[model samples]
Target: MFSPFERMVAGRYLRARKAEGFVSVIAGFSFAGIMLGVATLIIVMSVMNGFRQELVTRILGLNGHINVYSLSAPLEDYSIMKLQIGDVPGVTSVSGIIESQALMTINGYSTGVMVRGMTRDDLMKKPVLSDHFIEGEPADFVGYSAAIGRLMSEKLNLKIGSTFTLVSPKAKVTPFGGMPSSRTFTVAMIFDVGMYEYDSNFIFVPLDAAQAFYQMGKAVSSLEIVTKNPQHLNTVKRDISLITDGVAGVYDWRDNNSSFLNALQVERNVMFLILTMIILVAAFNVISSMIMLVKDKGRDIAIMRTMGATRRSMMKIFILTGASIGVVGTFVGTALGIAFALNIESIRQFLQGLTGTELFSEEIYFLSKLPAVIDWNEVIAVIAMAFTLSILATLYPAWRAARLDPVEALRYE
Candidate 1:
C-alpha cells in the first residue's frame, strides 16, 4: 500500500512539467515500447496456437490418430486385426487402408499421385474423407470407380463419369519382358479436404479395385485407428502395440508429422524469446527515464528527507511511478492483441487486397487463412514479466534519490 505522500509525489514526478520535457519524452517512449511488445507477442503466440489446433482437427482427422503396420509385409487378415484393435479400451474406430504411389493420365495431362484404397464402410467411417463430396456418393463407388480430389480434378479437367488411366510400377512379367500394370477407372466423385496438399495429390479407389490393380491378394498396407480421445493417443498406441505382440509397427499421428509440427513448436519458442527482448528494451528505457527524474528532483528529495520522509518512502514512490506505466501498457496491449487475434483473418484479407498479394498462400502453408487463438496463460505471463521488469528498473534510481544528503543537495542550490 502506498501512503498519501508517496502517491502524490509519484503522480507529480510522472506528470513532469515543461521544464523536465526530456524525461517526459523518455517515459512516453518506454510506455509505447512495452505496449507494442506485449501486443505483438500475444498475437504471434495466438496464431501459432491456432495453427496447431487446426492441424489436429483437420489433418489428423483425415489421417488416423494411430497407424498399425506390419513389420515386413502387408496385413493379410486386416479384418480380424481391425476387430481386435477396435476392442481396445480407448479405440473408437478401425479401418483397413491401402496407400500407394502411382501416376494418372487424363486428357493428355499426367501427374503423380498417392492412391488410397478403402471399402465403402471404411470410407464412411472417416467424415473427413466422406463428408465433402462434390460429385457422386460414396455408396456409388462400387466397381472400377474412383474418387479424385477437387484440385486434382481441376488440374486434369476431370468430371464425374470421366475415365482416366492408372499406371502402377508393379510390372507383370511376360514372355518378352516386364510390362507396367495399367488400368482404366471411371471417376465417381470429387472431394475437397480444404488442405491443399491432400486436395492436389490424393485419390480414392475401391479396395477391390486397388487390390486387383496393385496385384495385392487379401492384404492391406495398414490399419488406421481413431480413439475416443486423441490426446490419449500415446497411451493407446503403446497399449495396442503391446497387445499386438510387437509384430506390427504402431505409430501415432504426431510421429508421422513430427518434422512439420516440430518446426512449428521451435518457431513458436524462438519467437517468444525474440519478442521478449522488446519488453526488456522497454524496461531499460524505464531505468533511463527514472534516473533522469531522480537527478532533476534532487532538491525535492533532499527537502523530503529533511522533513522526515524515510528512505523506504522514496523507493516506494519511484517504484509506483515506473510500475504504473507498465500496468497501463500491459492492459492496453492485451486488449489490442485480443481484438486483433479475434479478427486476424479479416485483417489479413484487407492487407492482402491493399497490397495485391496473398498473405497466407495455400501453396506454402497447410492453412489457407490466417488463424489465431488467444491463450490467457500466455497473456498473464507476459504481463507479469513486464510489471516485474518495470519495478526492477526503478531500484537503483530510487536508492540514489533516497541516499542524497540534504546538506550537500542544498549547498549546490
Candidate 2:
C-alpha cells in the first residue's frame, strides 16, 4: 500500500535532506572499500593467470609437447622410432635429443647447465629455438660449438666466439678406482627466451657433439615429440606408448611442471578468497547504515503498521535499501576491476617510473618486469562473490525492521 507514512520514510531517506552526514560518510566509505577490493582481486588473479600462461608457453615451446624416454638405457635406433612415431595420429615431428648435465666455466665463472643436442636440420623445425637467437648463430657443432641461453652467458661472462669449457663427468676408469670424471667445450651463440630457469640453464648443441661429449655411442637420451595440436599431448603420448611397446616412458609437459603449476593455481585462489573478504566487510557497512535508518524512522514505521502495512512489507523496504547500496557498490567495483586488469601493464610501468624502481627486479623476482594476463573467469567470480556478500549483509537489518513492535515504536512519539 502507498501509505503517507511509508512514502514519507522512503522519500526522506532517498532525498537525504534529513539524512545524517555520518550515514552518508559511511555509505561513501563502503562504496570505496568495495571498489578497491574488487579491483585488487581482479588485477591479482589476472596477473597470476598471465604468469601461468607464460610459463606454459615458454616451457612447452622450448621443451616439446611430449617427451619419450627409456628408463633402462638410452634409446637405440631413434631414427627408426622417429619414423614410426611420426606415422601416428597427432604426431607432427619426432626429433632425437641427447641431453646431459654438466658444469660450464667462462672467465673463471662456473655454472651448472643442461646440454641438449639436436641436429641442425631438426633444430630448424623447432620454433622455440629458432625464435630466440640473440647472438651469433645456432648450433653448428663442427669443432666444439654450442648455443647458450642469454642469462647463462651473462652469468658466466660469455659472448659469441668465447671459448667456454663444458666439463661433463666422464666414465674413464683409473687404477685407484672406477669413478666418473669430467671434459670441456666452447660457447658459439646466445639465445634469450625470457624465462629465467630455461635461459639460465640450457645449452644447445649438435646431437653428435653431445653424444660424443657424454660418451654415449649409437644411443639417444630422449625423443622430443612435437604434436600438430599441443592440446592433444596426452593422446600423442598414448599413441607413442602403444607403438614403442611400453619400453619407453612418455611424459607430457603437464607431468614435468605439475608441482609448480599447482602451486601457482593454489596461490591465486587463496589470494582471491582473502581479498574478497574485504568486500564482504565493506558490505557490512550497508547493513549498519540500514539498521540505523530503520531506527530513525521508527515513528513512521509505527504509523505504517497502524495503517495495516504488513511486517513482510516493512522487511522488503529495508532489504531494498540494503540491496540498492550493494547494487551500486558492485557496479562501481566491477567497472574499476576490469579497467585495472586490462591496464595493469601500463600501471606497473607508470609506478616503476614514478618510484624509479622496478616492480619485478631481476635480482629479486627473476623477471625484469611484471607479467599479467587477465582471466575473465576470475573477474566474474569476484563480482559474484561481492554481490552475494552484499545481499547477505542486508538480512540482519531487514529482520530487525520486520520485528519492530508498532505500539512500542510509537509510544515515545
Candidate 3:
C-alpha cells in the first residue's frame, strides 16, 4: 500500500509541469502505445473468433457433422441405416445423400458443378440449406426439378421455373460409341448458404430424381448425419461404428474439411503471436518512460531521501506513477476494443457505404458480411498481459531511483 505522501508525489510526477514537458510527452506516448496495442489485439482476435464460428455453423450446417458410408458399395438400404444411426446415442438426424459431379448448361453457358440429392424432409432438417430459400419452396423440388445456389443462379442467369440440362458422366453405348447421359431439369428454388464455394458450385435435387437420373436405383452414395455435440465427434463416431457393425465407414466434419479448418486455426494462432508483439513494443515504451521519469526526478529523489524517506517508499512512488499509465491505458483500450467489436458489423456497413466499394465480398472471403465475436476469456487474458507488462516495466527504473544516494544525487544539483 502506498502512503499519502507517496501517492501525492506519484500523482504530481505523472502530471509533470512545463519544466518536465519532455518526460510528460514520453509518458503520453507510452499511454497511447499501450492503448492502441491492446485495442488492435482485441479487434483482431474477435474477428478471428467470429470467422471460425461462422465457418463451423454455416459450413457444417449444410454438410452435417459426420458422414457414414458403406465401405463395400453404395448404401442400398439407407432406410434401415438411417433408422439405426438415428437410434444411436448422441445421434440427432441421419439423411441419405447421393452426390455426383455433373455439368449444367443454361443459356449457352456450360459449367461443372457438384450435384447432391436429398429428400425434402432431409433438406428441411438442414436449416443452413432450408432456411435460406430465396426463390421457391422445397415442395417445388419434385421429380426432374432442382434447387440451385444463389451464385449459380446468377452466373447461369436462372430463375424459378427456368430449365437447365444436366449432363452425367454415365454413358449409353450406341452406334456413336458412347454418349454421356443427359437430362433436362426445371429450376425449382434458389438458396444462399453464404459460402461462395457452395453457392457457386452446388445443386440439389430430390433423392428419387437423382437416383433415377443416375441409374442408382434406391442406393445412396452416403449418409449425412448430425449429432448432439459436434465437438465430440470421435466419441460419437466410435458409437456409430458399434451400431453399424464396422461395415460402414464414418468421417466427421473435421475429417472432411481438415485442411481448411487446420489452416484457419494455424493462422489465428500466428496472428495472435504477431499482434502480441505490438503489446510488447508498448511495454517497452513503458520502460522507457519510467526510466526517463526516474532521471528527471533525481533531485526529488535526493530531497526525499534527505527528508528520511525510505528506499521502499521511493520505489513505490515511481512504480505507482509508471504503472498508473499502463493501468489506465489498458482499461481505456479494453473499453474501446469491446465497443468497436460489438459494432463492427455496423461500422463495416458504414465504411462500405462511404467508400461505395464492396467490403467482405462473398467472392473473396466467401462471407458477404464482416463478423465479430468477442471471447471474454481472451479479452481477460490480454488485459492481464498488458497489466503485468506495465508493472514489470517499472521495476528496474523504480529500483534505480530507490538506490540513488542522496549526497551524490544532490552534489550534481
lDDT of each: 0.87, 0.77, 0.89
Clashing pairs in 2: 166-185, 170-181
Q: RMSD in Å for candidate 1, one decimal? A: 1.9
What TM-score would each prediction reach against the true structure? 0.94, 0.88, 0.96
The residue-by-residue lDDT of candidate 1 on 1-413, one tens digit each, is 99999999999988999999999999999999889989999999999999888777787768889999899888887677788888889998888788999988877878889999988887877788778887887767988899888888888888999899999978988998999999999999899877888888888899989988888887988888988887767778878998667578998988888998899899999999999999999999988998888888889988998999998998899889888888888889888888999999999989989999887987787666778988899989988888888788888888888887888989968
How does candidate 2 score on lDDT?
A: 0.77
Residue-level lDDT of model 2, residues 1-413, one tens digit each, is 44565555554664454347766677677777877888777777877888878777777787878888897989977787789999989877888898888887766777778888888877667666677787776544455788887888777777777787777766656898765545456677677777777778888888888877887887899999888887667677777889777678888888988898898889987987798788878887877777777777788778878998899878777766666677677788788777877787788889988999867765455454467787777667777888888778888887888899999997877
Candidate 1 regions off by >4 Å? none
What would the TM-score be for candidate 2 when compared with the true structure? 0.88
Q: In model 3, which runs have C-alpha deviations exceeding 4 angstroms?
A: none
Q: Mark the 10 consecutive residues where model 1 has the least summed lDDT.
A: 362-371
Sorting all predicted structures by lDDT, with the top scorer first, yields 3, 1, 2
